[model samples]
Every structure is written in structure tokens, then in C-alpha cells.
Target chain A: MKNEIKIFSPATVANVACGFDVLGFCLDTIGDEMVIRKTEENGIKITKIEGYDLPFEAEKNVAGVSALAMYNALQPDCGFEIEIYKKIKPGSGIGSSSASAAGSVFGMNELLGKPLNNTELTNFAMKGEALASKCEHADNLAPAIFGGFTLVKSACPLKVLELPTPPDLFATLIHPQIEVKTSESRAILPKEIPLENAITQWANVGSLVHGLHTSDYNLIKESLTDVVIEPYRKQLIPHFDDVKSAVLEAGALGCAISGSGPSIFALSKSEATAKAVQLSMQNAYSKSNIQFETYVSKINTQGIKTL
Target chain B: MKNEIKIFSPATVANVACGFDVLGFCLDTIGDEMVIRKTEENGIKITKIEGYDLPFEAEKNVAGVSALAMYNALQPDCGFEIEIYKKIKPGSGIGSSSASAAGSVFGMNELLGKPLNNTELTNFAMKGEALASKCEHADNLAPAIFGGFTLVKSACPLKVLELPTPPDLFATLIHPQIEVKTSESRAILPKEIPLENAITQWANVGSLVHGLHTSDYNLIKESLTDVVIEPYRKQLIPHFDDVKSAVLEAGALGCAISGSGPSIFALSKSEATAKAVQLSMQNAYSKSNIQFETYVSKINTQGIKTL
Candidate 1:
């Protein structure tokens, strides 16, 4: 087996529009780089972390927590060392913690000669995710691991389905540098929603999945609506409606808050349109004096890759 | 255009498992037959009825109501007369009323030289459906018009999507000879449902649509679950759990109440398995002394067809 491996783990957008907590997709060009080394000694350690101020303790850190979970289960003959070169920002709502959580296990699994499947890896990664978000979730991690679009069909059983990615679809994301805690964002949601609205939400999800499979752009545009989540969560993000309208006016197929808020993502049929969408989002928020970063990329079909 | 047309409008299984009020499919070899004839008279009429006691008034009967809806929209050069050969029994929960409503507009549109498309036909059919169910719904009508599996993606400004049908899939339906009114079933449901359950429901719907598009039987089985409406509505059906267990034990891919209830449907991977599922459903209900009718049929890719 290889003694070490360097890999790229992609960022992901969870709670995709009408999908709420169930759907997410990965980005190809945006993510974190990690190096996993099979150490001579006997335990897991976070040797280095860069780009952002984060904990280096193995148990307290997201990446270390995930690596430790997998290590404890496998009981490998050798200890491991992890180095995270972070690029995705925390509290950005584009699944920054998930990228960290998934990258560690993915790199370690490769170093261990691929002992675990995506589902098994996701469970371990979710353990790490829970530490950061206060709840175990797979929507972000599944896409970060499996690539493309993923549906966390059931949380308890942890069923994750990898949905198809339309060939021409490109995602444009704008992250307004703002802190929107996942827990507080979750608190504002109503415990119960009208049954009629629920039906509309599911119907949109059903059609959206179909749209992806068939590469029907019109259907995707029509189905990319969130009646259950966005109406409430949009309140937390400044210029949410303006950005959404701007992207739609820029010819985006669909647009919505990426995960919880602060970051917004829009899907368009071409790279040109995606870039145009980025400019529109820029225009929408630039005047508001909110510092932001934008990215335009195709759907990542390969989750974590050896570098 | 033909002066007269005789058509078979297939019975549909709506509220399909996880896709409440959104998903449905047409069943071959099971439906109602109607003969629609263009007449010199400038109005619509229901000339003959057979096999059931039903209203013959042009505006009162579902077929007449749907035909009149289309007739009024077109104000065609001629009137039409409809003769019903109703085979799907009313209050059977197998979209009996939808079959009738769809059949008339389908036959009338044929005689009128295909003036309108499936979406237009669905809109007219939903009007008649509203007369029977006291609500405008397209789950049943959409599939009956579009053929195969369909998702009623939106109710207002009705957008219906025709989803791909898996080749090996077969349906087994059991209609218990008991009354389960749509309104009563609707009354039993809570106006608001837990947000958590709604998430589960939409996740299943998203996966189920994926499964159908990819023809993944295992994914289909896993996704064929209803967490929102089934729990409350299944109570109105006799021996719902017993029959479900029986069908699942017989190697059926999935099972759920067809539409509102009293009728249950199971999907299997093959015609043989579907027949076996029917037998299992028979055995489950046979001991209870409930009069029932069972059917095994492939998906009707051709919705309303000429007889």
C-alpha cells in the first residue's frame, strides 16, 4: 500500500432549493487540498492546517474527527497524519465543514488501499460534520464524496443516492462574507408546515431529479423552487431576493441559497451564462457594501481525487 | 378528422407511494371505454351508459363535464355525443372518475382534429375531477393523458412531466369492494405535517424519480415509501398493513394505497412477479371476507387508445 496520498476534496451546496435537507451537488474547481501520510507511530494527528484559523486537535477538528472515526473502526496497523490546506471558508454555507470532514476519510481510505465504500465513508464523515453543525447530515458530504448531485434519502439509515448531472449545467456561486450559524438558521424554521406546501416541495423535487436525468433545462427551471425553506431562510440573508432576481434575469436556470444562507448558488445551461450570472450577483450585492467571492464551475463528477 | 372515435382510457394509480398528489402511472388492460361521435347539433350529450348507475346529464356526469369543458373552449363547428362503457367502478380509489373525465376529452379531442395537447386536455379533465373529488388535481388526469409514469410538477398553471418507465416494471392492483370517499380521506389528514416528515417524503420522491429514470429496481424499492399522507390515509383502508406485508414478502418491489384507499397497488420487476403479488394480496384479504378484484398489468405507455 502507498505510504501517503495528496487529494482534492470539492466544496458542495446542500439544501438545494426545494430539496431542503435532502439534495446537494459538488463543485469541480473549488475545494480544499489535503495530504494524508501513513505515520510510523500509533495515532491520528492533524499535522498542519492553512488558509483559515481552525483547530489542529485531532478530536476537536472536523477533518481529524472524521479520520479518527474511520481509524477507530478499521484499527489500522499504522497511525496516520493529516494536513489540510483549506480553501473553502467556514460559516459560508457552501458546506465548508463537510469538505473538511469528507476529505480526511477519502484520503485515508486511499492510503489504506480502499477498504470502505462511499456509504461507509459518509457515515464516518458525518460524525465529523455533527461536531461543526450540531447535527449529522449527509447531503453535503455525500456530494463531496460521491460527486455530482446527491440525495440523502433517509438520514437515520443514511441512504445516499447519487443523481445524474446534466452535461451542460454549470453552477455560479456568490459567498457574501457573513456568519450565518447553521443552528440558528435552523431554529427559525417552523416545526410544522402546511401540507399543501409540502406537496409542492416534493413535486418540485421529483421534477428536478427528472430534469437532471433528461437534461431538460426548462423543467429544471420550473422545479428549482423552494416553498418550504427559502421563504423563511431568505430573511437572514441581505439582498437574497435581489440576487435571485438578478441571476434569473441573467438567464440562470435556477437560483437559491446554497445551504443555510450568506452564500447563494445559481445553475445555468452554459459556462458563459454561469459567468454572466456571477456578474449579475456581483452587481446585486456590490452596491450593498457586502464583501463577496464568486465562482463559476461545472458539476464535479469526481468527488475527492488523488493529486 | 374522424366523425366518431372509440377509446380506452386507462385507470391510473395516483398518489404513488412517496409522490403524494404528484406521481401517477397508467395501467394497461384496465380502464373504461367510451365512444364519442360528432353530431350536427351544437351541444354535448351523454347518450348511453352501461355497467354502472351514473348520471346522464351533460353537465353532471364526469365524461359530459369534461367533454363540455373542451367543447366550450373550442366552440367547435359541431357538437358531440358520448357513450360510456364504464368498467372501472366508482369509489374504487383507482382513479375511476379520472378515467371517465380523461376519456371524454380524449375522444372529443380526437374527433375535433387534435386541436389541443395533453396539457390542455389535462386542464379540462381536472375540471371534471374537481366535480368528483371537490378539488382540482392532475395526478390522475396527467398520466391518463400523457401515458406511462407522470409527475404533476405544479397544480396551478399545470405543468405535467412524463417520466421514463422502466421496461421490466409491472403493477398489481387490488380493489376491495368497500367505500373510501376521497373527501373523507382528505378530512382524516392533518392540515399541517411535521417538517421532518415532509423532508423524508420529498427525499423519497427525488430518489424514486431517479430510480425510474435509471431503471434501478433496488433504488426504486428503497424510495417507494410515504411518510406524509400514507400513515393517516392507510387507516381508512381495511387490512392495509397486512396486504402490504404480504405483497412485499412475495418479492414485490414496492406497494402502497392506490390514490386515496380501499384499492392497493404493488409494483414488481416482472409480469410473473406482479401476478404473484396479486395472489399474495388475494391471500391477505381472502380470510377477511372482503370482496375484492385484483389485476396484473404492464404500464400503459399509450394512455387513451383507440379501441
Candidate 2:
């Protein structure tokens, strides 16, 4: 079937709260769309963008790499004409790069009669992420491919599981007008952590996992606190802790830095709490009087889909 | 109220195979007893064992310290005559010391009209373990206090939860006749793990907790793997890999070191599989000219109770 397959890939919050390097959840706020059509060309060629500018080169671009990886897995000779519409910004830290990669793989696989399982597709998408980040970390790729709250159990062989996300789970994303490079933020983390801090991190990670599975909002709030990474990364975001505090005071379940960011995610149990959280975020940045965008979204259960 | 109280504290597997610092489970096979009398001495006193040359001094003996800690917490100026009857072997790596400490707290708390919560009594029991090992680790104390499979959510504040045990779950313990000093075993573990390994550990920890809460047997088996700790500790246990192979080959779901020890545990789905596992362990050790004692046990639900 050499037909057009249009797919949607949701934005994701990687390094979800306490689960650094292992957890993420899809966001319903924004996503990217990719249309893959079988073409006569020898390789994947990304055609056009509906919004922002992204590389269209076959080998250099993330979407192109993602399509190539999938094609190589099944039929290396199959050519794909991929058109990507980037709704999420390229450097936005809300899994910007993953959306393109996920959309490409998802659309291409659908067009090709669906040969790969979600895990296999995740592996292909992860390769695309690896091409851009120079490392195969599955934190972003899992949620983008499988949706819901996801955990990348292993990055090497790519074991991604869709965990049971809490019902009434709402997320508020506040992206301040600032650029924080993912590479730079990652490099800033200390190469070695004190043994005491490592133990504490693992304990919190355990608790967070428990909270997520049990839907214990209070435990999740307690578990979201990062004593090791966020302290260092918050220096990059103006009014970071203030924003967190304000949202929490406004009845957020928990709040923490959303990836390597000028953005932060606050969890709330209800739409009203989410609205209050949105206002709190605006007020926190009002001191700097900086313009910021806020998104009140239900946790995205349908990750990447054909649109 | 002056009364005779008989309390039974179950022996526990501290390290819980995969979860080195964060998990443990109580077992019914072995334990100790402490009989506390409301004496008018106005201070805590330890009466030594009938046969063995165990410590009798208040600060030096584990049971005495536990009783004293409870007294200090509750009455602050009361007398306790604690008699120790240690049944769990001294260096079994099956939380023998924890049994004594927990038994002391259980006996005295009953005698003191239960003035403390389980958490509070656990805190008191931990003081005894601290005095015994000179290290403040809670793997043993958690299960001994709470029973079933337990998770140590926090160390500083001592948060412990009793996780549900699956009905089909069975464990086969193989205590090889060898002595590996707890301190030496502890020293062999690496101080730092790759961030990747740490993340995988947490993912499994989450799955394990979920498995317990939902009674998912396969999930429990899947979660019972150690990528961070067991690989390093294998050196201390002779024929470790071979024993694990034997256990698994005999249809055991999972197997690993029981604690900081010369003992190992294999979990299975049925009594037959458990018996097969026992034979497998015995066969593996016998091939290496080593003797081992094996016990098959279901998860203990009642932690410390009057026997």
C-alpha cells in the first residue's frame, strides 16, 4: 500500500519528576504531525513543514533519520516521502526532537502495513534520538511512542512499558521566554554524586514509582522533589522555585523542572486546581514581568496516532 | 498491667535478592523470643541465655538495647527484665539480629500496654540493630517489623510499608555452610553505579511494588532482577552463577543472594517447583563439595506476634 499516512505524535515531559533517566509521560498540549507517502526516490525525504523551520535533509534531520531507521529495519529499498508539521518548538525541551522522530516512525509504519511492535518502533525512534543527542536515552522516546505514563526499563534493548497513569491526572506546563540548551544543562550535572545523595535519590525514585502505580497524589508530590539535579538546573531558570512554590500553594500535587528547562511542570488533581496553577505560574513570572505560555492538559494517554 | 506476653518475631531476608537497600520480606522458618517482666529495678536489665555465652550487659546485648530503647521512649523511668532466647542463627544473613531486636520490642511493647505505634516500635527496634552492626541499615528491621514483603520508602524518617505477597509465591532458601562477614560483603559493593543501571533498578522497583499491590506473579518475577548490586556481590558467594542456573533450570522464577551472605533464595510458583528448587540448590552445592541447609517458606503476613 503506497498511500499517504498522516500521524500525530504528542509532546512529552521527559525525566518525569523523580524518575530521572527512566520515566516520562505524554502531554496532550501540543504535538507534531507527519505525512508519509511511498515515493519513487531511493531514500526518506521530508517534504514540508506547516509551522517552524526544521532541516529537510535526508540524513541530518531527526524525522528523516527516524524514517530511515524504520525502513532499514523492514525494507531498506522502500522510499518514503515524509512531510513534517512541527507544532512544538525544536528547542522547547518538551520532547521537541522526539515528536518529529515519533511522528515519522509512526506514520511510516502505518503506511507500510504495520510490521513493528511498539517496543520495536520505540527502538527505531530511540535510534533517531541517539542520532541527535549522541546517546540512546529512552526517557523521551518511550512516552512519545507508547503514550500514557511510560518507563524505559532498558535503553540498550529498548524495554518501554506503558504504566497506569493516575485518573484525573492533569499537567500544567509553563514555558518562560528563555532558551536552555539540553546539551548544556546535561553537562552541568556533577559527574559524581555523594553516596548519601545517591541513596536518597533511589529512595525517592522508589516512592515515586509506588505513588504513580497507586495513584497516591500526596506521595507523588513528596516523591517529585529532586534534591540532586533540580537544584543545579534551577539556576538556569529565573523564578523557578518561586513558580513551583506558587503552583503548589495553589493546590498543585507537585511541581518540578520539566526536563532541562526554562519550563516547569506542575501536577494538579482537577481542572480547577490546574487553573489555579496556571494563574500561580503567571504570578510567579509577573515579578520579572516576563511573557510565558501555560498549558492545562490531561496526561496524554494516546501518544502517537494517525491524524 | 503485669502480665506474661509471648511474642513471635519472624526471621526476614533483608536484601530481598534484587533490592539491596530498599526491599525485604518476612519468613516463618526461623526467629527468636524475648520475655519482658515488669521488674522494680527502675532500669533495663538483660538476663543472659541459659546455655550460650551471649552478652548480658545492657548496652552490649541487642535485646537489652531494644528493651531499653522502648522503655526510654515510653515510660522514660521504668524497669524491664528482658530474657533472650535466640533461635535464629547468629550469622545466617537471614536477619537473625533483627529477629532478636524485633522480638524484644514486640514483647516489651505488649508488656507496656502498647503505648507506641508499629512505626514507633520499629524505630526502637532499629536502635538495637544499630548497636549490633554499628551501621544504620533497615532492610532487616523493615520486614521484621511490618511483615510480608516490605519497602523501605525512607531511611531518615523510617517510612516502611507492608507490601502484599502473591498467593502462588514460594521461596527456597539455600544456606551454604560458609561464613562471609557482613562487613566484608558490604565493602565489596561499588560506591557508584552507571546512571543507566540506577534507572533500571528503579523501574523494576516500581514494577515490583505494583506487582505486590495487584498480586501480579509474573510481574513480581520480572521485577526480581538486580543489574546494579547482585553482579558485584556474586564474587562473595561460591558457585553463584551455577547455583542460579540450577535453580532457574529447575523452574524457579528468580534467584539471588538472600542478604549480605553465604545464603541464597529462589522464588517459585508452586510447591513442586519449590521442591525442585531445593533439590537444585542442594545439587549445585553438593557438586562443589559444599553442604547447604534448605527451607521452603510462604510469605509471613504476621510480622512480630506472640507465639
Candidate 3:
């Protein structure tokens, strides 16, 4: 058995337009890297944190917390140490914390001879997310751990389902250099939504799942509309409407706030259109004097893999 | 061009458990039939009605209204007369009105040399639904017209998407001899839904769509749970909980009130299980001294076809 392992977990876009808190997809370009090694001690330790300022305490850091959860579940006498290199920035609304959390558990699972399945790893990773966001949600963590498009059927038992993705599908992500606290963004949403809007939202979600399975571009385009959450969450993001309109005009199939806000993403049929969407979105934000970074990528078919 | 055509439109189960007003599916056993023949006159006439008492006027009856809509759209310089044979009774919550409405448009489309596509046909059929329920909704009408599992992406422009169905999937429908007014059932639901409940509902809807496409029975079972609509509508149906429990215990994958109520449907993996569910549900209702009819069928892949 391997005593040490290195793994990478991709970033995820949660909500996927109309499927708020239920749908997410992995990204190929941006993610977090974790190196996990078995140690003589009986607990988890965080040896290093790079690329971003994050907690080093095993219990406090997301990656370390996830690793510890996996270790405890295995009940192995040996301890583990985790080193995280974060590429996905926190509060970008692109599942930064989830990559760290999922990567840690995934790496530990490999080092321990694969004691847990992907769903169980996702469950442990969700605990890490709970530590960060004050709630346990698998929308981001499931995709980060399982790859591709993922649907969280239920969070209680943590049923994660992998969905089909068209081979030609591409994504454009624009991360503005701003922070929209996930908790604050969530708090801004209404506790109750009009029953009609709820119906529309579920309709879009069902259509989106159907579109992904069938690789129907027109269906995806029609299903990307958000009538419930986006109308409320977009207020926290700067230039939300202008950037969305620009991306749509630039031939993007759909655009929406990535998760909570401060970051936006668009899906396209080809890499060329995705690049054009990136340029259009960047220009829109620049016109408003907002600094942002853009990444264009194909949908990540491999969620977490060995490095 | 053929001057006369006959078509059959399948019965539909809307809501599909968790996807209220968004998802629906067709059944093989129950439906409505219409015969349309072009006439020298300039409009539409409902010359006959059978199996149920419905308005004979072109504008008042669902079938006649739908046929008139198709006639107006074609402007074929000819009138059409329709004869309706309804097997799916109205107020059964099994999409009786939708069957007549969809059947009328489908038959007229055939008589007019296919002037309109399925979406356009669905639009006219929705007008028929509006005549009965006073609201233009197509959850039932789309599936009745299109066949198989369907997702209504949007209602304004009438975007309908057909989803894949598993080959072995069977349905058991136990329609008690009772009437649950669609309008009143809808009115009983709250105008606003809790945001948390909405999230659960959409998650289930997304999963159900994924399950049907991928043929994952467990996923379908998990996704059939309803936390938003059924809790409110079940009260209108007598012994709803007992019937549901009985069906589930009898090897059904999932069970719920069909459409708005008075009819209950269960999904199973095999024909035998479906029949078993039918018996269990019928027995449960019998104990309550309620009269009902039962049907066991494979999913109707052919939504509207000539007999």
C-alpha cells in the first residue's frame, strides 16, 4: 500500500443556473492540490498552506478537517499530514473551499488503501464545508469529489448522482477580485418564494438534467433561465446584469452567478465561444471599473485524480 | 392531401411526485380519440361527443376549442368537424381534459397535412386545457401530446422536452371513483413555498429526470419524495397515507397522488410488481369502502398515434 499520495480536486460551479442548492459541475482548469502522507502519530496535522492565507490547524482548516474526518471514519492507528496548495480562491463563489475539503478526503482515502467510497468521501468533505459555511451542503462537494455534472438528491443521507456531460461543452468563469460572503449572500435570499416561481425553477432544473443527458443545446439554453434565486442573489454581485447580457450576446448559451456571488460563469458549445464569452464578460466588468480574472475550460470529466 | 384523420392522445400523470406543474408522463391504457374531417364550411364543429358529457360547441369544449385553434392557425379555406371518444374521464386527475385537447389538435394537424409541429400542436392543446381549468398550463397536455416522460421548460412560449424512459418501467394507477377539482386542489396550495422546501423539491425533480434518463431505479426511488405539493394535496384524497404505504410495501419503487388527486399512481421495475402494487392499492382503498378502478401498463412511448 502507498504510504503517501497526492491528489487534485477540481473547482465546481454550484446551482448551475436554475438548480439552486441541487446542481453543480466540475471545472477542468481551476482546483486545489493536496499531498497526504501517513505519519507515526495518531491524528491529522496540517504541515503547509500555499497560494492563499488559510488556517494551518488540522481541525480549523477545511482540508485538514476533511482529512481528519476520513481518518476517524477508518479508525486507523496511524496519523496523516496534509499540505494544501489552493488555486481556487475563497469567496469567489466557484467552490474554492469544496476543492480543498474534497481533495483532502480523496487524498487520504487513497493513502489508506481506499477505505471509503466516493459518496462517503463526499459526506466527510461536506463536514469540511459545514465548518466553513455553517451548513452542510453537498452541491459543490459532490462534484468536486465525483467529477463532471453532479446532482445532490438528498443531503441527509448524502446521495450524490453523476450526470452526463456533452463532450463539446465548455465553460467560462470570471472571478472578480471581490468577496461576497457566502453566509451573507445566503441571508439576503428570501425565506419564502412565490409558488409560481418555485414551479418555474423546478421546471428549469428538470429540463437542464434532461438536456445534459440528451446533449440537446436548445434544451440547455431554454433551461438555463433562473426565476427564483438569481433575481434575489444578483443584487450582491457588481455588474451582474451587464456581464450576463454581454456573455449571452457573445454566443454563450447561459450565464449566471457561480454560487453565492462576486464570481460569474457561462457555458458554451465550443472553446471558441467560451473564449469570446470570457472576453465579453471581462470587458463588461472593465467598463464598470471592476478587476477580474477569467478562466476558460472544458467540463472536467475527472473530478479528483492522482497527481 | 388527406382530408380526414383519426388520432389517439394518451392519458398523462402530471407532477410526477416532486415536480409539480413541471413534469409529466404518458400512460398506454387510457386516452381520448378524435376524428377530424375537413368540411366545405369555414370553421370547426364538434359533431359528436362520446364516453363523457362535454360541451358540444367548438369554443366551449376542450376538443372543439383545440380543433378550432388548429383550424384558425391553418387558414386552410375549409372547415373541420370533430368526433370525440373520451375514455379518460374528466375530474379524475388523470389529465382527461388534456387528452381531449391534445387529441383534437393532433388529429387536425394530421388532416391539415401537418401544418404545425408538436410544440405548436401543444400550444393549441393548452388552449383546450385553459377552457377547462381557466389557466393555460401544459404539464399534462405536453406529455399527452408528445408521449413518454416530458419536461415543460417554459409555459410562455411553450417549450416542451421529452425525456428518456426505461424499457421495463411499469406504472400502476388506482383511480378511486371520486372527483377532486383541479382548480380547488390548486387553490388549496399556498401561494408561497418555504425556500428550504423549494430546494428539496428541485433536487428531487432534477434527480428524477436524471434517473429516468440513466435508468437508475434507486435514484428514481429517492427522487420520488415530495416535500412541497403532495403534503397539501393528499388531504383532499381519502386514506392517502394508508394507500401510499400499502403500495410502497407491495414492492413499488415510488407512489404518489397522480396530478391533483382522486387518482394515485405507483412506479415499479417490472410488470408483475406493477400488478402487485395495483392489487395492494385497490385493497387499501377497499378497506376504506371507496370504489376505484385500477390500471397496469407499460409507459406509453407513443404519445399520439393513429389507431
Candidate 4:
């Protein structure tokens, strides 16, 4: 076919604080690049893999799975070769797998003259993630593919909403030297919840959405408390409480686990607070001799792009 | 007292199904009217009471207590004579007490030449509720004072947000003869909730808020389910399950107990569904041989109006 299409997908913060499987937002720091080429062949195949050591098998790799799903659905006659350059670290709280998955669908859709809309791309990308993670979750993929803070309402009807992120939200994320296996983390969470706490969590979640829409900083702060996952998950992260306290004491609005564990994100109003949060994380980690890399960046309103 | 002001306070729905103590909305169906006049005396006095044979003592009766709080706060160098024209039933589960409290504040605020903002009025109204219920909550008063769907973020600092109501939404409310006291209803809820259920509720609540803001009908329908409160509270309402089933079967978008309810509310897309819901409630209530009154109407967006 000899058709070439290039696309970029941003790194994403999945399970944003309290929003376990429902909320995600794009990150500007790291991402993946995928280049799709159509050739005169029977089916799709993976031509190249760069940046990280991901699978070369087109059906097993995240990017490959996503691209293959799209190809199968669209039933493109031309054979396509996908080249994925995965920059984000796989198995990190930052959506590495989702980026690759999103990148594959994004590139393939572009290569096929944009047959699939964002929703369709998100579904195809989620199917790709399911292939890798053994579960279908699209919070990360949707935002990475579509941009902005996104909510995945359902997987069946595939309802996705791109929420407007607050303007002055400077996020400070610290990924400690611990690697939390996604499978292990997923196992620890309980399936059933007591009725009352569930009600409160939803109230805060509703408030959080409203805060984003209205730009109400105080509401955002109030809604950021994760009474569900963080309470149980924080035990895995060293100095989680100390780091959270330091960030809040240093003028950060709220702090919580990023996705599952190891990575913690704090929000601040100004550059000073952002810098302070970065320092606070370093300080908290220093006492425990736990080294961590921190990112002090603004909200990534723009998700993925053609680069 | 000859020179004072009269104000109208709208009916409010507290413990708004999925959002207990956090969400409330005002309605135009039932309300209370209060007249406050400055007299030569040194303290507030309730000269007249109508609708319900409530206590007339200024510090004890909800209307009288609300007026007393406002009078004490303002310290206006005059005693006030209050007349309450209460329309909301005493045990209607439709924010009956809140209407009395809010009416007093609205009336007193008007008499005081609108000295307080809506937030301040809500505070005084909540104080009145505290005197009546022994609990200081803002859910009902906030909406009654502010109008529309409201979220009370912090009761201490007093933050309230009026959320966008879903469009083309009609409601059918059926009030049976049974009475479920708020205090008793609250006691039944479990204090601690499971983490998983909390996450699900938050996800749904987040989606609900988005649905309201965006006016997405399907999202609203999906978000309206209460896994936390409705199941437990339904036991207190006679024929609750049948009423809910009938309403849903008759084409209600959703149905739930209205507040700590013997009163149930069902939402529908059109007036036809609203009427159908009313008939369904009647059919369900027929089993108990308890005659019920049903109101088929759209959301009373124009909350309180001067007659």
C-alpha cells in the first residue's frame, strides 16, 4: 500500500486521586510515537519497536493490538506495518501501556483516512489495553487519545466525556524508586464497599467534576480526598503520609496516589507551591533514603498530537 | 410591629436520593410564607401560626427559632412579630421543617432590608434546623435559599454551588400516609463503606454532575441510581419496591425515595411519563389500601415567587 501516517500520544495519569477507573488526564512530560505504513500484503504486522522493549508480535503488543483491532473492525484490505516508539516506562503509574495502545489506534485511524472518531478510537484502544492488562479500562486511553481530563462512563455504550481542566493547576508528581506491580495492586482492592462511604465518595466526585467545570479551587481541594483506594494503597508507598503532609503544609492544595502506588501527585496554585511540593517530596523521601523523580508541570490540556 | 417585610420560601428536597446532606434542590409545589414586623418589644415573638399546630415559642418552633437567630444576629433595636403561613406538611418528607426555617430567614432578611447574602441566609436556616433536629445540616436550606440543584461543600466556611439541572426533566412525586423520620432514617445507614462501592459511587456521581452540566439524558439516567441510600431506605416506605418498579415499567427514566422518604419521586422525559408514573404510584399504593397524592410536574426551576 505504501501509505504512511504518523501520530503522537501523551503520557496519562490514570486513576486520578479518587477516580479509580473513571478519571484520567494527559501528561505533557512523556509519551509514545507511532508511525503506520500500509503495504500490499494480507494483514497487519509490526515493522519496528523503539524507545522501550515492547513485544514485536503485532497481536500481543499494546500498540499492535490496538492497531490490529482497528484494522479488523474497519476491515482494511491493505496490509499495515506499525512502528511504535514507546517512551513512557511500562508498568509505571503513568499510563505507559495506554499510551502505546492509544498511539496504535491513533496512527492507524489517521492512516486509514480517519474512519474512527475519538469514541471509536478509545474503544479500540481499550480493547488493546485489555489484551495486555487482562481487563478493559479506558480512562487513560481516552484522555491520551482525545485530550483533556476524561471520564469513562461505560465500556459497553462507550460514553466518554472530555472535561475542561482548571487553568492554574500545577501538578507535582513524584515517582518513588518502588515498582508496584499492577496485578498485585489490583488484587489488594476490595470488591464490596460499605454503603455510607460510597455515598460520600460519590458526593465528592460530583463536587470534583463541578469544581473542574466552575473553576472552584476550594471545591477541588475538598473533593481530592481519596477515602477509598488511598487508605489501603498508601501502605505500599513509603512515607506516603509524610510526603502528603509536607506537600499540604507547603501550600499544595491536595495530594494522593497517582494511579495505584509508588507515584504520588500534588496540586498547587502557583509556581512557588509547585516548587515547594517538589522540594517537599524530595525532603520526605530523603529521610527514608528513598530517591524519587518529580515533575512540576501545568495541566496538560492538549492530549495527543501529530508529531 | 407595623413596619416589616414578608418573604416567600420555596419547598426543598433534602437528602436528594444519592446525595444525602450534600445535595438539595428547591421546588415550587409547596412553600411557606412568613411576615416579620418590628415592634417596640426587645425580642422576637411568633404572633400567628397556620397550616401546622407547631410550637409558638420563639426559641423552640422552627419558624420562631429561625427568626430568633436572625433577630439575635442583626440585633435590630426592636422586637419582631412573626406570622407563619405554612403550606408544606409537617411530616411530608419534602423539607417541611427546612421550609419553615428558610421562610423565617427569608422573611427576616427582607425585613432587615436584605442584609445577608444567600450563604448567610442558609447558615441561619441551618441553625434553625439544628434547633429542631439537633443536627446542623445545610442540604435543604441551601437549595431553598439559593434555588435549583445545590451542592454544599463546607458547612463551616459555608460554600454552596447551584448546579445545572438536566433539561426536559419531569418529576412525579407520591406521598403516602407513612412517615419516616429523618433521624430514624439516618440511623439506618452504615457509618463505614467499602472502598470498591465508594469508587463506583464517585464515578457515578462524577458522571451525574457532568450529565447535569452537559444535559446528557442517558448519563443522567445512568447516574440517578443510588446504590447507597435507596435500597436501605426503601424498607421504610410502604409499597416502595412496587412503586419504583411500576414507575420504571411505565417509562420513568429513574425513581428513588424523596429525602428520608415516605414520599417517592420518579423522573421522566415527558409529561406523559410523569402522568404514567403518577398512575403507577397509585397502583402500587393500592395494595396497602393507603391513598396517596401524586404531583406530576417538571422541576420547579422558578423556585419561590411572590404572590
Fraction of native A-B contacts kept, per candidate: 0.99, 0.39, 0.96, 0.66
Worst 10 residues of 1 chain A by lDDT: A154-163
lDDT of 3 by residue, B189-238 (tens): 99999999999999899889888888889889888988998889999999
Would you list the clashing residue pairs of candidate 2?
B6-B306, B7-B306, B8-B305
Cα lDDT for residue B247, model 1?
98
Residue-wise lDDT of candidate 1 within B1-307, one digit each (tens)? 6899999989999988999899999999899999999999989989999989999998899888888888898999899999999999998988899999999999988887788999999999998998898889999998899999999988889999999999999999999999988889989999999999999899889998999988999999998988888889889988999999999999999999999988999999999999999999999999987899999999999898998
lDDT, model 1, position A101 = 97
TM-scores across all candidates? 0.98, 0.90, 0.96, 0.92
Sort candidate 3 into its docking category. high
Ranking by DockQ: 1, 3, 4, 2
Ten contiguous residues minimizing lDDT sum, candidate 2 chain B: B45-54
Q: What's the ranking of the predictions by lDDT, best on top?
A: 1, 3, 2, 4
- Per-residue error for B140 in candidate 2, Å, reads 1.0
Q: Model 2, stretches more than 4 Å misplaced?
A: A1-6, A36-43, A76-81, A111-113, A289-291, B34-52, B76-81, B111-113, B189-191, B213-219, B287-291
- Superposed by TM-score, candidate 1 places the C-alpha of residue A4 at a distance from the truth, in angstroms, of 2.3
Q: Tell me how candidate 4 scores on lDDT.
A: 0.79
Kindly indicate the candidate among 2 and 3 with the higher lDDT: 3
The true-versus-predicted C-alpha distance at residue A214 of model 2, in Å, is: 1.6
Every candidate's lDDT: 0.92, 0.80, 0.88, 0.79
Candidate number achieving the greatest lDDT relative to the actual structure = 1
Window of ten residues with lowest summed lDDT in model 4 chain B: B298-307
**Model 4 lDDT tens row, B1-307:** 2277776777677655556667777776667887777788788788999887988888888877877787788898777788888877777777888888888777666666778988888888887889767887888788787877887766777878789977687878888977678788888877766555565566677787787898887777787777777767888887888888898899888888787887888778888878987898888888787867888766766555444
Worst 10 residues of 1 chain B by lDDT: B106-115
> Mind giving the per-residue lDDT tens digits that candidate 2 earns over B248-289?
999988898887877899889987899999998898888877
